[model samples]
Target: MQDTGSTVPRRQLGRYLLDWRTRAGLTLVTAAELLDISHSSLHRLEHGQTGRIKIGQVEAACELYGVPEELAAAFTGLARQSNGKSWWHEFGDLIPRDFDVYVGLESAAVGIATFQPELIPGLFQTGDYVRALNRAAFPNASEELQDAWVQLKLRRQHRVTRKHRPASVSAVIGEAALRRINGSPKVMAVQLRKLADMSTLPNVELRVLPFRAGFPTGLWVGPCVILDFGITPAGSPVEPPVVFIEGSTVGNLYLEKPHDVERYHRTYDRIRQRSLDAVSSRNLLRQVAKEYLA
Candidate 1:
């Protein structure tokens, strides 16, 4: 009995091709020879490990494996999915692999709610702010790598600015974050002024949790993003909202469990309720910026 349990989609696609090849009495080397591709390449195809799978390669692999058109189509779809550029790919090796998944998720998310305590969120940071941050965060990063990371951060910020596909963003920052000077006073002033200007965007809702707001539960958790993947409606596939918590090294914790998602949603609501309104928040941010400017 061919065990099909625990087969991931990519692995299943690979197995489908492999079974076809075996039934056709073709060895891996023989199949590779017939396809005019390398044995190692064929092995990777069989294992579904090809990230940049060429159309010709999928077609050749299917043909050599005697795969049916429909089955071949499925594998081709998988190959295309594998070949799709993940958002983090823009950062190259500068971004750690664990953090890469969050970038990918952020790219696809339609709405975002964030509660940040220590620093500005990535999607809202200016290039100067991001440059300063990247330098501090990755002290060992090369200048070129820092530049690349900053560029990637700027591109991510465009999600809230793009005319057609803007993400609906709501950010609640702690008062301390606004008061803290990230870079030089001049640079910090520029970044804060940008934040003040951004508060007016129709799609953006910026709120600040003032020191007088008393303590809040959300404050204890550090920074987190609650991403809402718009509703699918009845009879459609439902992608539940997810909560992303950044980890220390590079990767982040993706919370998709219903209970965990609900917890963050509730937490965001509590923080929002406890925070100052948009107008007040903008004024507070400006006030802090003024202090830094002086």
Candidate 2:
């Protein structure tokens, strides 16, 4: 059995399997028995600690869990791709189409360091802003569909806002992102004010990279997020860090290599260094909101 170099996809797949199993109301031992696997083996697979994921076993488990056809296919696809060092979830691909692998990763992450060059990070986006973007992105979609998308974004924000163990967020937003008008001026004003308010949260550290900080990295950097899982009591990472790069036209990229993660961390550090401090950023956000209101 070959070891999977990166655990990102495996972890994501495990999360999905676990969710399905729980929803099916099956105990771990019962589910393992139904899938014809040992309890320890099933436990390992559910924890993303298994080696050489067998596609057949994944399919059997999905079948045993009564997962839908599309979702079952998606899980199998993830199992097939779990051996790679890095995973690119193409927008057109079956796995990404049926399931959002990134959301699972984000939910499991303990801390996130993100740099956004174009738009407000999803965690900080207001409902109106999200609705506006969704309407624009899916112009032919129904209002109900748009509302669903908006609600999804809002739910994702709970990661940073929940009362218990909210994830730590460090975000550096480009000035351009703040100035860009997605919805009406009123919407922008509300959105900016929300950003300012959210920045006040103890777990969130928000900064803005002004226009004056021209090309801190000597090049244009696209939106990227670094997700760090918490460490164990022994001081070792619970799971490896992943760098998620959002591709506007193609698909999302997950980099799990040490070098790739380190490079993005360095870039994020440089960008953060050039950004306004938390107080200054909050001030700028309010000032911008006032300008929008005016």
TM-score of the candidate numbered 1? 0.67
Pairs with backbone N, CA or C atoms under 3 Å apart (clashes), candidate 1: 98-251
Give lDDT tens digits, candidate 2, residues 1-294. Answer: 555667787888998999999999999999988888899998889899987799899999888889999889889888877865557888345474647788889999999999998899999999999998988888999989888888898999999999899999999999998999998999999999999999999999999999999999999999999999999999999999999998766778899888999999999999999999999999999999999988
Clashes of each: 1, 0
Which residue window of length 10 is worst by lDDT in model 2?
91-100
TM-score of each: 0.67, 0.96
| lDDT digits (tens) for residues 169-204 of candidate 1 | 999988887777787877778777888899899999
| Cα lDDT for residue 10, candidate 1 | 39
Candidate 2: global Cα-lDDT?
Answer: 0.91
